[model samples]
Target chain A: MQPESLEAPTNRPIYSPVIVNNKSAHHLFICEGYPSREFQIFYSSVDDSKKTLLLVSESDSTIDHDSILVTHSELTAKLTQLLGEMPLSTTIYVLGSEAFIWDVHSVATQAGMVAEQIKMFAPVSGQRRLFCTHCYHITEDVTHSPAVCSGCQRNLLVRDHFSRLHAAYVGVQIDAEDPDDLPLPQELI
Target chain B: MSTDQIKVRVAAVAQVAPMIREFTLTAVTGSLYPFSPGSHVVVEMPGEQKIYRNAYSLLSDSHDASAYRIAVRLQDNSRGGSVFMHQQVKEGDELLISPPANLFIPQWNAQKHILLAAGVGITPFMSYLPEMQRRQADFELHYLFRSKQTGAYQLELAEQLGQRFFSYDSDQAQRCNISELLADRPLGTHIYICGPEGLIKDVQSVAEQLGWPDSVIHFEEFAAPKPGKPFTVELKSTGKTVQVGESESLLEALEEAEVAVPNLCRGGVCGQCATPVAEGEIEHRDNYLSVDEKARQDCVMPCVSRAHSDRLVLDI
Candidate 1:
């Protein structure tokens, strides 16, 4: 019997499809993910064909047969190059996990991109990260069962409540009332 | 010598509008205190009876450190502050004032600045125009007032700002449509509104409905405080409870209890009086906190915010 986590697949793979909008952005930057059908629909809607797409995924395959970069260093270099060359009129769309997207966002903002200029989308992958509400410690890639908060040294069950400001699932004390009735081990977060 | 206090002589006093009066304060000895574009000074007006401390934004050019200019709009029901300034305060009289502090500042990184002002609310925006024109930044000013004769800086704005300035007089039945003003704004455009509570609330709500995020929308609300239900504040360290009257602010109540707290603008525009809440619910009345910060329910500016609960536990 596999252990059970607080959350399981809700028929929709969350970490797969990051963002879904046909706003026709000037630049589309994709990280490692494989919802190729949705990606095709998104990129097709955009009219910018000349140097508008940059795939920073480690995977060999890309959606539109455009530009590709594998390594993190290469991604950084390309981001810097693109941000420097482009004017403030450019609209950027970013797709990746919580941590990965924020990393790209930090770089973009440091390069003088207004928050309004960029749109970030979280993937629908099963990879779940939990953030402790108490000590505010973020536990990354917790796949199975309630985990002890590394921040405040308390056992926490990942709550369904997601904070857009914190960019992670909120985790509260699992054994608040009765310590003996600890949360049962769970999987598939 | 008090480090925070600056001695200044009132250089000139002139009626800028119907209810508005401009007071020019030059330093008594050394040059006037240096301040940013959107800075305000707390004036200590010592009348024959008591001293009334009121904060007024500096309307003069930030580069001009020799003098500081502020406009005071006399309130009919004022608590002796504006009335004293208008009727009693004389030019060449030396006065003590707190050094300038900036709670409202411009977005330097913005591609365009949309400024909305109402009557005397145009004071802060006046400080920004010189810097904006110096940088050649794209900007527009929308001024709303009672009438042409009652609006401050009408002739000066027309002469200096050319077509960049727009005005709407209520007496003339003209209105600055917030929706139309904020519509079709360019990306990276930051909107700043300074005026009455109604203007701030209306413009902000309209901007939000138009899909503008809180980051791009900025406002400074110096809305006068209103009386609320009496409440009790318990000091976390001393366990002392201070009874706040319906007519008194939490800051006033705390002071009456001899619990010292930092304060500048009693109007709640400044964030100096923001104190952390150890426990209990807070009815935030200040414009300092953002919508998300208010939702957090962790901090409250006692200068304006009253207690919704019977008792509030302040970290003080």
Candidate 2:
């Protein structure tokens, strides 16, 4: 099933809410899922605030400030429609790494919008997300060396994310610090 | 006397070809139990100095189990099992034997039986031939070999089955047009095929186009290809996930992940490795499952199957 339309499971894969970083909010890219981030922090690095929304593209070079948008396949249209009428100050970024996304990006670009704003955030090490079987939301920060998911309490080892897409979604975010520190569960957040 | 008293003695050994070897075993218990055609026996061979159990198809006619015939083809890349069976085994040696077990057999009353064999895949069919002749069953045999020279028992099989036998020698680049040949046959005939990955795939795709269902197709594989890449695998029950490299089969990957998947022949022939595929796509490279099973994407052989999706998800 596409990431969209996925409902919160009555029986969650995880029970304990462990430490999570701000970047975990991008799981929102999957849509209909809860966005979990501590607090939206102001810029300390990269683009400084000029009241500008950074339009991250799969390719930074291809990003034309005045051009149409381009991005990954399925999410492009919904994203384009959502952002197409927004002011030019809102910069969009597209994730690149393959053809399917490339086509989506190209189509978005031709639609008379900024194509270069799509950010390409590849999953980084130590910054990982875990699907909570109990909660059915992609969660983060299990404990132990090969950590057991705080959600389901099952041992979470590397490569386990690919078996079933159900709770296997994980992507690394740019700024993740003290991932071990437990935070309030999303139910409370 | 008892099952424990039965013993098999190797009467002769021959390295018929680089990859193929024949073992002639005679039951030393004075008498042997009857084994049906297409039956196989598990033989214990000396491993280093110890014994290891290996299953081999009985090539000798099933009418007499007192004497057994088995053929083993050494995998090009040695895993020590086949290579050792060919290297150390000698004439006049005794090996433990199991009663014949078969996953392939002829339906005695079935009107038509179509047999398709590729190289060493012909071993099981070799046993079926005598039964077909005895019962005067309407059977047709098609043997496919890389070359005429590679065809085993070419003359003998043809002599026994007469005009019903067809040969495809890849060496001479001669192969019968199976699709065209089968087009005229009646609908009730069962089609059995066994061979290499490429050939099996070809036959399956063609059969699908021809609208053949699962009941019509049966097959076995002598070898299986390892998957292409190492990727991530997730276990649902425990919510545990593991990395499976391209070098390892899904079964091996699961084993490493500490997930037990029931399996017998890791070569993708036996259906023991069959498990439910709850999610994700797979690159099927097995001979066991029917086309319908493959289409449903519900079951797969972990021993030799690979994932088509970046990450594969399975129920088991």
Give the winner by lDDT: 1
Give model 2's TM-score for chain A to 2 decimal places: 0.28
Measured with C-alpha atoms, the lDDT of residue B193 in candidate 1 is: 83
Model 2 segments more than 4 A misplaced? A1-189, B1-7, B17-19, B28-33, B42-55, B94-98, B224-262, B273-302, B305-316
DockQ, candidate no. 1: 0.07
**CA lDDT of each candidate?**
0.75, 0.57
Q: List runs of model 1 lying over 4 Å from the truth.
A: A1-91, A95-113, A120-189, B1-3, B47-50, B148-150, B230-236, B239-246, B256-258, B277-281, B289-298, B309-313
Residues A33-53 of candidate 1: C-alpha lDDT, one tens digit per residue: 544556557666666552366
Docking class of 2: incorrect
DockQ of each: 0.07, 0.01
* Candidate closest to the true structure, highest DockQ: 1
Interface RMSD of 2: 28.5
Over A1-189, each residue of candidate 2 has an lDDT whose tens digit, in order, gives 223224633221222222222221111122111111311122222233222232324443322243233332434565546544433223333222222233344443444332223332222123334554444445543322344455555443323233222324332221135446533322111
